[model samples]
Target: MTETQRKVGFLICLITIVLAVLDLQIVSAATVPIVRDLDPDHGVDKIPWLVSAFALASAAMLPLYGKLCDTLGAKRVFTGAIATFLLGSALCGAAQSMEQLIAARAVQGLGGGGLMSVTMVVIAHLKGPDEEGTGKGGSAGGLVAGAGMAVGPWIGGLLADHASWRWIFYVNLPIGLAVLAASAFVLKLPDHPVRRPLDYLGAALGAAFSSALLLVTDWGGNRYAWSSPVVVGLIVTAAAALALFLWRQTRAAEPILPLSLFRVRELRLGFVIQAIVGAAMMCAIYYVLVYLQIARGVASSSAGLYLLPMAIGMSTAGLLSGRLTARGWSARTFTLSGTATTALAFGLLALTTGPATSLWLIRAALLLMGLGLGQLMGQLILLVQFAAPRHQLGVATTGIRFFQTLGGALGASVFGSVLARLYAADGPGGDVSALARLTGTAHAEGVRAFVSATDVVFWSGAALMTLATVLAVRLPRPGRPEDTEQPARQPEPVPA
Candidate 1:
């Protein structure tokens, strides 16, 4: 591919990633309008399904998408995924009822699964011979994602309030169509000559496990009690499916997620660190918003604006890290520094929690948190890609994303339960929103209690990030004697 073609391919892939991120963040802001227009009477009850359906279906398709990328080639898989996503988006825009819309979201998610993961594969392929793939494209992708996160909900709110709710989905069509067309013309992906039989049975089992585990996390202790039959049954199902999937992986001709990849220390550490960063991100974003909305009495839309500083921090770090990596800074150096920065941010957040704590202080901590995390996502994937065998690039890239998504789900569930328990022990029992409705003294007490609970949550996040820092210390530094094993294992080093 020529220079102009590479740039175009990169642009198309980034737009596709924006589509994926926007869809995830966009829906929440439009829900109230959707409920009113679709089924005001019964829609409220089914609202959770909107998020759940997309999340479950998307998670379920990830492993399969990775395999498809390697076999069919990234360009073919990329165009197909975009076409599927556009089809689903059209269906979503035209849906007349809540049920239909939810179903359409599930369809959209099937394609959405690849929008980010496979795009990373494509980006890695875009690198020219002699160009450093030290995460330049991945860092740019991260910056785009952070911008999308910062602006997505605000854009959704703007559209839903001023235009039709359907336009939210409709808006994706033009942009997505353009991306799809450009990719087909511009992306000249390397061909994979060696074809192997796909493990359909293993894929099915893996999908089943991912779906069940996501459901267990989403529904547990919120929609159903932890001990309820529904949650218990899902737990058993997830366990059985996971066990069977692992067994199948060991025996399959081409496993969906090969166990052999984990034997590489860099790949293993990269995966674990990616997961920890994902979970910590949930703590930073979700709990901060909760605190703002419930305790500080900030409106939801305005509360979202608070994330801008963090987003800026993320974008800046991504850009800066790309330059630093080019200057001989190893992935290990960034990992250690990033993890330590995030841990300190969390520790500061935990110590400063109070009903009257300044909002600016929290914002500062968030900015620090983002700076810390920004260095990890792209660089870690670069590390894993460098460590993994060339044949396994697709699975390895997607595997990082898979672990992160699971980590987010599990962390959200666990932290949510902890917050609930801690609050119930001190505050008047019920939703944290109740704190918003309380009057003077009671409201003051509620704020204090909520602050107290979030303090613990931040501390927990701090502890987790600290643990990641310790693990990062073990990562092999670039150009060092310890790093020789990784390059020795990947003799080809995955072509630029």
Candidate 2:
């Protein structure tokens, strides 16, 4: 692909990528009201299924869609995913009951899985090894994706509050249509030989395993005891199914997700780090929205407005880093510094349990955290691609997405459960069931204390980012700063 052609194709792909990410958090601000209105009598525990259902569907369908993209053309798969998103969004908007909404969300996730799974592959084709493989083009692709992820909450909140929660789904309709048209005209993705005889047994078993594990984790604390038969059953079923899935993959002629991608040290480590950091990035959105709505009594839209600062901070930092790398700064320098800063920000957030924390302090912490995170988020994938053989790029990218899904799913189950147990509310401040956990004045101060405990949750999330820092430090030193950090490096070779 020439420069002009590559720019148009990648830009169109970025729009679809943004829409996929937007769906992930666009529902966060609305979840509280959506569940309360739809299932008023149900326990808070049942609500995570709303989030997990979509996540579960997306997880199950990702490898399937990825394999299909390889078998069919990228355009066919990408367009189909967008259409699924639009249709599912309409169903969600028209849902009359919780069951209808959950079912619609599941449909939406089928398309979402495709969009999330395929963008990385689309990007790799755009940045071919024969062309400029790693540079501004590589880093910008992820930076744009990160920016999309950052804005989802703010946009979700604004739409849910200013209009109706249904608009969150409805908003995708026009955007998806626009992207389909642009991509048809501007994108120039090349063709690949189709793989036949996809591993049906492995796909089925993988989906079953993932769904069971997600359900067990999401509902264990709220709807059923963790030690109960239902949770235990799901756990055993998930383990058996997953084991079978893995065993079958090892022997299969054509695997949906090849087990061999783990052989590349940088790709494997990158995926693991992405999972840990991505979980923190995603779970923070979930909890912060809850904190603003439930603990702080802010409106759905108001929560979004406050969160906008983080988006601005992250974007500004991302663009600046891109510019810096363009000027010859080594990716390693930014990568290590960014990871360290993220760890530091989380530490500061952990100490913010008191009402006495200065607003300026909060904003500064968010800015520092965002700046550091943007660097890692933008640079890591380019490093992974550089480390992998060209033919395996699609599988390698999917591995990154899979780890991210695992981390987010794990964070949702564990973090959501812990938050529920800690904040059982007796007063008007929280869900009534949560209050029943407290006794007397201690109860009053206890919930108050726990309300301030959002910091602890934030801190736990920060620790995950700190882990990302460790892995980043272990990476083999960059071959050359120019090789992975700048667009100039792409069009021109850099000296070792």
Candidate 3:
């Protein structure tokens, strides 16, 4: 591919990723409007499913998409995924009931799963074997995706308030169509479909495990007690399904996820670090929003506006780090430094949690946190890509994303449970929005109680990031001459 062609293709891929990630957060601000319009009577309980369904479906299909990319070629799979997403978007926008909306979201997520995984694989191919780090292209892609996440809620709120909540889904049509048109014309990768058996059984088991596990996290403390029979049953089912999946991988002709990838030290470490970072990042993003809306009594749109500082910090740092790494700076150094910086930022946030705390102070801490997160985001994938065998690139890339998604789900569940418990103990019986209406002394006490809960959350985040720092310290430095030149070896076939 020519330089110009590569640039165009990369941009198209980046746009797709941004859209996929944006859809995840955009609905948050629109939830209230959606409920009011759709199933107001029972919508509050069902609204969570709209988000949960998408997440669960996306996470479950990740491995399948990875394998599909390898078997059917990235172009075909990617284009199909985009079309499927567009279809889902149309359905979501036109849905008449909560159940219809949730089902549409699941369809949307199926396509979204491919959008992230296949694009990374395509980018890896574009970078070729000689590129040592996540090049400028990959870093730029990450930056755009992060920005989408940051702005999604603001956009959603704007639409919900001034226009219609349906616009949130409808908005994707034009952008997605353009992406498809551009990719069809600009992407020039050769497509040679492999005639091999896919691991159907393994894929089924993997999906089952992922879905069950996500359910356990999403429903554990929110809808049911942690020790409730349904939660415990889901946990057991997830464990059993995962065990069966792993055992089946050893016997399959073409396992959807190659277990051997875990044997690579760099890949293993990269997964671990990605999981920790994902958990910490999710917790920070979520609770910060909670603090803004519930404690500070800000509108959803304004809360999103406050997130801009962190988003800018992330984009700037990601671009700079990618450039430096490409120029031969050690990725390990950036990872370690970023991890430590994020931990420090979290500590600062814990200290500055009171309602009377300066908004500027909170913004500064969030900026630091985003900076730290950006440094690690693209670099970790670069490490994993560089270490993985060429044949397994799709699986390896998706594996990182898979673990990260799982971590995010787990973090949200655990942290939400903690906040609920603390809030109940401090001052019982009020919905999140109702707490914002407290007056005088009551308001002061409510804010204090919210701050106390946030303090614990941030402290926990700091500890997680500190652990990530230790793992980053163990990561091998980039720019090894031999490592860059090593040819892509044919990966071993799955056991028959």
**lDDT by residue (tens digit), candidate 2, 245-285:** 99998999878777765655566678888788667776655
- Give per-model TM-scores: 0.96, 0.85, 0.94
* Backbone-clash count (model 1): 0
Better of 2 and 3 by lDDT: 3
Worst 10 residues of 3 by lDDT: 479-488
Full-model lDDT for every candidate: 0.85, 0.70, 0.83
- Per-candidate clashes come to 0, 6, 0
Q: Provide the RMSD of all predictions against the true structure, rounded to 1 decimal.
A: 2.3, 5.4, 2.7
Q: Model 2: runs farther than 4 Å from truth? A: 31-47, 128-138, 292-297, 324-333, 417-444, 451-455, 480-496
Model 1 bad stretches (over 4 Å): 430-433, 481-496
Best by TM-score: 1
- Candidate number of the best lDDT: 1
Q: Which pairs clash inside model 3?
A: none
Residue 286 local lDDT, model 2: 62
Q: Give the worst 10-residue stretch by lDDT in candidate 2.
A: 486-495
lDDT order, best first, reads 1, 3, 2
